[model samples]
Target: MAMAALTAATTTATAAHVHGLCSSSSGFNGRKLSVALPRVCAPATSKRKRAGGVAVAKYGEKSIYFDLEDISNTTGAWDLYGSDTPSPYNPLQSKFFETFAKPFTKRGLLLKFLLLAGGGGLVYAGSNATGDILPIVRGPQQPPVLGPREKL
Candidate 1:
């Protein structure tokens, strides 16, 4: 991913579009650079059954692993991927992406990723059978009544 820098001193260039992660070095003096931004694309309204299914999607400095099942159902499915926290065990949520935009200022960055869950009961309508408009004209209506010819 590409990273671009923008100076806050200049009022004309207020925002900068970075392809990947944005950190403190991403901005100039006085300007504050933000890291990955959260972007939720879960269906605004859905009646689908939530389960223990988890999905992970990454974009720029943000790595999202969310599941509608975890939010809706009582399955108690937990997600601990791509976290900065360390664990005593070897298996722990690690930081896949990081952005240090600034120690104090946190702005000027955006990260977007979409996660869509299976929709609720889908209504599939049967296709209507349209009668053929033209009559079957290629083949003869009746089979040829062949007669056994005598030996020539």
Candidate 2:
């Protein structure tokens, strides 16, 4: 009974001491977090191409839909790219792309996994308190050089 009373008293004292120090509402509760940078691309007039019996733009590994008639009707569209007609593809480039481009795409999962494992190992070694662990796992140390004091 005494132990329960002491715990209750301590809890009440801690609560009272921390009263008014915390606010239930924060200013950032209603704000949104934006994680992407602004999108940038080439101008629309210089991005159209007519190939494989369709008017489309080369978007990554696939051709995307485009409106050639709309582009033709637009005033001053002919002034773009010095003549406004789509450029012709080189035969050698097209042959190489058709032969061996789809088989090799970039993959970085293994590199990311190795980096994550190394970071986790460093964190585990730092947090575990035992004998000397600095010699086996350590990073370069640069001593902080103090400069003259500021007058602020």
Q: What is the TM-score of each candidate against the true structure?
A: 0.13, 0.17
Give the per-residue lDDT digits (tens) of candidate 1, residues 14-62: 3334343333345446555644434658886678768886786663245
In terms of lDDT, the poorest run of 10 residues in model 2 is: 30-39
Q: For this target, which candidate reaches the highest TM-score against the unseen true structure?
A: 2
Determine the backbone clash count of candidate 1: 3
What global local distance difference test value does model 1 have? 0.42
- Model 2 TM-score (2 dp): 0.17
Query: What does the lDDT read for residue 51 in candidate 1?
Result: 80
Task: Kindly report which residue pairs in candidate 1 clash with one another.
Answer: 23-101, 24-101, 37-111
Residues 47-132 of candidate 2 have per-residue lDDT tens digits of: 67755675666733455345455665534465664875554888888888966754334256556667889999999987886655
Prediction-by-prediction clash tally: 3, 0
